[model samples]
Target: MNQKQLVSSALASVMALGLVSGAAAADDNKGKEKCYGIAKAGQNDCANLAGTHSCAGQSKADMDAGEWKYVAKGTCKQMGGLSLAEAKDKTAMMKK
Candidate 1:
């Protein structure tokens, strides 16, 4: 194939792969809930409620009451974690 066509094919392949992976991740979270105050240090799923960071695995402390991870729905409380509302309250209380 021509060089231009080859590059175009490669770029399309990469884009397709990204879309597929993103869809898979979304499906994987279908049955999960955001459970706060349960993630270990450096194990959070995404940004903390405090907005100190905006990526996964960026938590600086264990059970910060602001960091959260995906857990099976209905299991957060059983796991000693909090829902989003509860987590917000706990985080607010911690600032006092």
Candidate 2:
């Protein structure tokens, strides 16, 4: 190919790559489903990240009562478990 054509092709390839990479999904905050008159609920998947990461949102009652303090955050590949208390502790530390 001519010099100009080759350069244009390279530029197009780089732009395409950037678009693909940027399009990848990012970690999103979990969603809270309002727990009405019900007393208890089971584990619920909140968000799916990159076909690997999955999370479980804590109930509103637990958050308000501070009874079951915890949230699930991790990827399907490398998941690090965290309890509500532990998460609170971590957030406190981060604020410092």
Top candidate on lDDT is 1
Q: Give the range where candidate 1 is weakest over 10 consecutive residues by summed lDDT.
A: 86-95
Indicate the TM-score of model 2: 0.28
Q: What is the TM-score of each candidate against the true structure?
A: 0.78, 0.28
Clashes of 2: 3
Candidates' C-alpha lDDT: 0.95, 0.40
Candidate 2: stretches off by over 4 Å = 25-96
Residue 35 in model 2: lDDT: 27
Q: Candidate 2 at residue 71, lDDT? A: 32
Please provide, for model 1 over 1-96, each residue's C-alpha lDDT reduced to its tens digit, 9 standing for 90 to 100: 999999999999999999999999999999999999999999999999999999999999999899999999899999999989999999898899
Clash pairs for candidate 2: 52-76, 69-84, 70-84
Model 2 alpha-carbon miss at residue 78, Å? 22
Which portions of model 1 show Cα errors greater than 4 Å? 1-19
Cand. 1 TM to true fold? 0.78
Please give the distance, in angstroms, between residue 65's alpha carbon in candidate 1 and its true position after superposition. Answer: 0.6
Looking at model 2, which ten-residue stretch has the lowest summed lDDT? 62-71
State model 2's lDDT.
0.40
